[model samples]
Target: MSMERIATALDRVSAALRRKPQAGIHDDAAATARWDGGLRTRVLHDAGHELLTDMPAEIGGEDGAPTPGWFMRAGLASCAVTRIAMAAAAEGIRLETLEARASSRSDTRGMLLIPEADGSAVPAQPLEIALHVRIGAPGVPAERLRTLVEWTARCSPVGCTVEQPMPLALHVDVAS
Candidate 1:
């Protein structure tokens, strides 16, 4: 979509929220994933979209697709870029280039039940995720560009979700 269109949509949503804050609040995203026997076959469904996740052969998968962590990183990177663009549009900045690099670091000791190099236990998940965003817009000041990037990081949904911890509940059911 064009930047003008995106700005218009954002303005519309902002107006709606301002008019009825409570009515505008919603959280109803639902996705289901099903896993079959081998090859790290996991199919996820959300709304009308479907995503397949798999692991590499080194970890016992057929390398059919990217791992779940990879997907998460990609989502973060995509969200950062989109949010930056949205901010730029709102601020009337014509972006010439925008690039976001997202990376995560994890230790296999936790999943593989191996000891850490220092004889300590590794965390159950990745230790850190990093996002490096570079943006360019002619005639825009460097300070304004930095502010846009900072604002995007503050408000991006995926980035916020990754930084914060939320309550989770799990249940298992068996069929006869």
Candidate 2:
């Protein structure tokens, strides 16, 4: 959609949200993943879309698809891009170029369950996640674009979730 349309739509939503703040708080549909075989899985979303994940051959997988960690990084990049674009549109900034890249460093020892020298458990999460964003808009100040990117980082849902600690619950079912 055009930036003008996006601005109009965002304004409408903002007004509605201001009037009924509770309307913004709601649960999203759950995504279910089913194991397909050795280190491969298929995830189904509520919208009938499916995503596949697989480990490399070294990890006993066929390498038919990308690893789950890859998907996580992709999600982060895409979410940041979307949020940045939305903000740009709302602010009447005509963006000529916008790109976001997400990268992380992880230790395989943690996932492989290798024992540490100090006997401390290795973290399964990435050691660091970095997002590099390149954006430009004709006639817009560089500082303004930087500020927009910074604001988008704080507002991006996936970014926020990854940055903050939240409670998670797991349940198991036994089948006969």
Best by lDDT: 2
**Candidate 2, number of clashes:** 0
Listed in order, each prediction's TM-score against the native is 0.90, 0.97
Residue lDDT tens for model 2, 40-74: 99999999999999998986999999999999999
Error of 2 at 28 (Å): 0.9
Candidate 1's residue-wise lDDT over 127-146, tens digit each?
88899999999998999999
Model 1 superposed RMSD (Cα): 1.9
lDDT at 154 for candidate 1?
91
| Residue 144, model 1: Cα distance from true site in angstroms | 1.0
